[model samples]
Target: MILIANSEAWPGFSKSIECLRRGERAVDALVAGICEVEREAKVRSVGYGGWPNMLGRMEFDAGVMDGATRQVGAVGAVPDTLPVAALAREVMRRLPHVMLTGDGARRFATELGFPIDETLHPDSKRVWWERLQKELSPEALAAFPDIPLAPLSHAITDPERVRDNTVFLGRDSAGDLASVTSTSGWAWKYPGRLGDSPIPGAGYYADSRFGAAACTHTGEMTMRCGTARTIVLALRLGHSLRQAVDLAVEELKDLRDGFIGGVVIHAIDADQTHRVVSLNCEEPIHYWFWQEGMNEPEKRAAERV
Candidate 1:
């Protein structure tokens, strides 16, 4: 078995590894790790405590891909819910649809008895207010939730928020690979803005026969390029892991227009060989890695080209 996840997933990756050690299903193990990040108020990149949308709502996005089946389940722009990654897995198991969003997603969780997590960390809310107060005029602040936010969305930016998401990719003992992507998305984004986290073939793609790939942060670039699927296709077409990753980076570099930023890719081949690379990112990236026979996951720096 092999497992690799972005650094933000550190909080709960151990549980995921443990599940794999005990021979649990690959998707289950991936969810086990991501749920830990989702439920923590401190992670601030995904799940409960993450920064909210322009209106101060904790809207979440998450997705799961089962490599053996090529089936996907995802939720986007959901509000008042926790354990979003787990709910996405449930969408795969119970529903025929590949994705759900907004009120529909919330309703599905309710039908299955997922609890409403009314708790957005107080500090997160405070920080959001502080930023809003600085960006919006007193009249705009007074108008608050009643005002149109999409116009202001681009105006109020959180430089760090766009660069955060929890990405996990794993292959189990049975040769089944899986991936989970979870995030609160860009802070102060327009209401109902859905990034790449919930989109299959863009943010995440898995194929037990070929390989699995996941990307974080820059969803816009990946969405247009279908980056995760591109990496897997490159691997399936006989590209080496390094070559496939670089190809994806080259594609990103080709995009000379539109919103663009850094992206981190985590990938693993059918033989359990893994690679991580960052593109146009200001800082180095690190991720957790472990393969069969390893006692613990290693924290390694991602390659930058």
Candidate 2:
């Protein structure tokens, strides 16, 4: 068994391996593992205290994939719930649909016994205010309290500051692979904006035949390129794991509309060998991984592009 996840999800590594060691299905172990990350208050880009939207509300998004069946479930713009990862799993298991969004997602989560709260933690709200202040002068903000922040307008806010995504991938004893991705979506975004996090084959993908791939960084690039799936497909077509990731990173070079600050990809081959790749990243990238015979999860730096 093997588990690989973005470095931000380090808190989940041990628990995920434990679930795998206990013989849980790859999907189950992956979900169980990410739940720890989602519940962690320190990771503000994910569940719970994640950066809020322009309206000061925390909306979350998550996706889950089952490699053996190629099935997926996703939830977007869900508010006040840290269990969206589990909810995505429930959607895959109990619902015929692949996704739910906004109020519908929140309603479904509530029906599934997930908590619903609109109150942002003080620290989270403070973070929101600080970001807002970066885009608006104190006088302008006070004069137009009802005005919505427009991140798309170069004259307004800097959207780059809000970008973040997280991912987790696992392969079970039988070699079945599965993946999960969760994010608060773009910070200070429009009230109901949805990103690649809840988009299948965008945020993550897995196939028992070739293995799994998942990513963190620019969601729009992933959504446009189907990056995670692209990596796995490259592997299926005979590219080495690192080569597959490199091809995906190379594709990002074609992006011309905006700056791609960074991108990090985590991949695991059918043999359970794993590789992490980072493209144009400003700092060193790291990821967490674990397998049988390992006493604890290990953190390793990725190959930088």
Query: Candidate 1 regions off by >4 Å?
Result: none
User: The CA-based lDDT of model 2 is what?
Assistant: 0.82
lDDT (C-alpha) at residue 218 in model 2: 78
Judged by whole-model lDDT over C-alpha atoms, candidate 1 comes out at 0.89
Q: Model 2 compared with the native: what TM-score?
A: 0.92
Per-candidate Cα lDDT values, in order, are 0.89, 0.82
Q: Which ten residues in a row have the lowest lDDT in candidate 2?
A: 151-160
Q: For model 1, where is the 10-residue window of minimal lDDT?
A: 154-163
Best by lDDT: 1
Per-residue lDDT tens digits of candidate 1, residues 1-305? 99999998989989999999999989999999899999887787888768888778889999999999999999999888888999999999999998999999999999999988884778878888888888888998898878777778678877465557899999998999998999998888888888889999999999999999999988989999999999999999999988988899899999999998899989998988899998888987899998889988899999887
Residue range 1-305, candidate 2, lDDT tens digits: 88888888876778888889988999998888788888787776787657777777888899999999999999998877887889999999999999998889878888878776553668878866776677787887796557645642344343345477678899988889998998887777777878888988787898999989887877778888898899899999999987888888888777878646677888898988888888878877888878888888888888887
In each prediction, how many residue pairs overlap at the backbone (N, C-alpha, C within less than 3 A)? 0, 0
Q: What are the TM-scores, per candidate, against the unseen true structure?
A: 0.97, 0.92
